[model samples]
Target: MDAVSEIPDYVKRISFIDSNYNWDNERYGDKLQKWLEASSDNRLFVACYDDANALLDGKPFVSKTGGTWHRTYLMQRYLKKKMKRLSWNKTENDSIIYFTADNRRIQFYSRKNPEQKIYHTILVERNGYIQSVFSGTKYEGMGYQFMGRKVYDMYRQNSGSW
Candidate 1:
């Protein structure tokens, strides 16, 4: 857990598509441009493309609107990259928290002291954000309680962002 904090925050390159057909078919080329331009709140940070190699100097954030197809596209790409990095091991111990964009679920898995492992999943808005100290899976009580409170607390703490 300490390692997670030590790893400096960096901008991430979010792709819009992957070889797998996990996203709905849609070509918003011009519409996408117009939508992004019209909604100032819908802008994505340029630094996001830097990946973990370069730390972002500014705070990170994502803006989303009524574009399911676009989100699905992004998810496919994001998942593909993550999957490659994960080597198809969804249950890998390295991943404690997983934002499964395709399923719209954020899963938190636990690596118990010895050999126990548990997982909990919660739905979240695509571009929504959360700051949390996610409890492990075996402690279902804390996990469930934090599920509701952590998000609210993060929202309250980051009120100015919205």
Candidate 2:
């Protein structure tokens, strides 16, 4: 449903007076700088628990937040682990998670589950605020499987790595 709409009047009416923009503008630089400053040992996590939490963190069904703006335990863990690939000492050549400027989306590919074809991604709005995240399926209640196994499987990630 997120993509099936027509642009109103051929131009989308988007408002920028939002807290997500302000929150990102204030912290993105500092967090990015901190990530860049981390040593080879890489102690500080760029998208740390407290850091990656968006302004719409606890909110659901946010318009710009990748559909239902849902958050699952499995999705959160995968996102965190995949985000670590953004740290220094990591080479893009070996990257499974890639950032594309085309539409400002961070595409997460499950290398091992290339056949799963879940189509997961995080959208970084032009404002540089990471707001939306589509974790493969629309809703966990829809029986979305990671690697043919249920998300309830605590070790489902072992079935596929994003």
Candidate 3:
């Protein structure tokens, strides 16, 4: 499943850090550097796109905030590993869908237990990477808990963007 090409044309483009464009090179570089260095846990995982026109396009990146560094780092690492393990395949067993909020359409994919219909992992896709990730065990039911709401709120407060 080629996620990039599969993105619908209607989604807006947002820029992110990559080999050609580093996060430090953007207008918010100084603040981003300070944020990234302050605490490892205070971060928001975001998806990016190379061609979309929204504020989160380009390479997937993490935004810093006033949260627990270790947990965020662990979640980021875990999501990355899980995404890699899934091979980006979206089939009936692995559901991929989109929803509109704040005037933007967001893409999400979920890995669920087939027989029980319980989700193990849910990830937001941006620039072909996992932007936001949520996971739960079958014992916990299907409700998904977002990891970095505070970080994301801080981003909205500072950047006037989402």
User: Could you say which candidate leads in lDDT?
Assistant: 1
lDDT of 1 by residue, 56-140 (tens): 2443222232222234435434544543432222433442223332122222222221212111122122121222222112332
User: Candidate 2: misplaced stretches above 4 Å?
Assistant: 1-23, 43-60, 65-97, 100-162
- Could you tell me the lDDT of residue 37 within candidate 3? 34
Task: Provide the overall lDDT of each model, using Cα atoms, as 2-decimal numbers.
Answer: 0.28, 0.26, 0.27
User: What local lDDT score does residue 135 receive in model 3, on the 0 to 100 scale?
Assistant: 14
Clashing pairs in 2: none
Q: What does candidate 3's lDDT look like per residue over 1-162, in tens digits?
A: 123423333432322212112322223333333343343332332321221111233431333322122222233344334334222222333422222121121122222222332111212212122233221112211232332222233223545445
User: At residue 142, what lDDT does model 2 achieve?
Assistant: 48
Better of 1 and 3 by TM-score: 3
Clashes, model 3: 15
Would you list the rank order by lDDT, best first? 1, 3, 2
lDDT score for candidate 2 against the true structure:
0.26
How many residue pairs clash (N, CA or C atoms closer than 3 angstroms) in each of the candidate models, in the order given? 1, 0, 15
How far is 86's C-alpha from truth in model 1 (Å)? 2.2
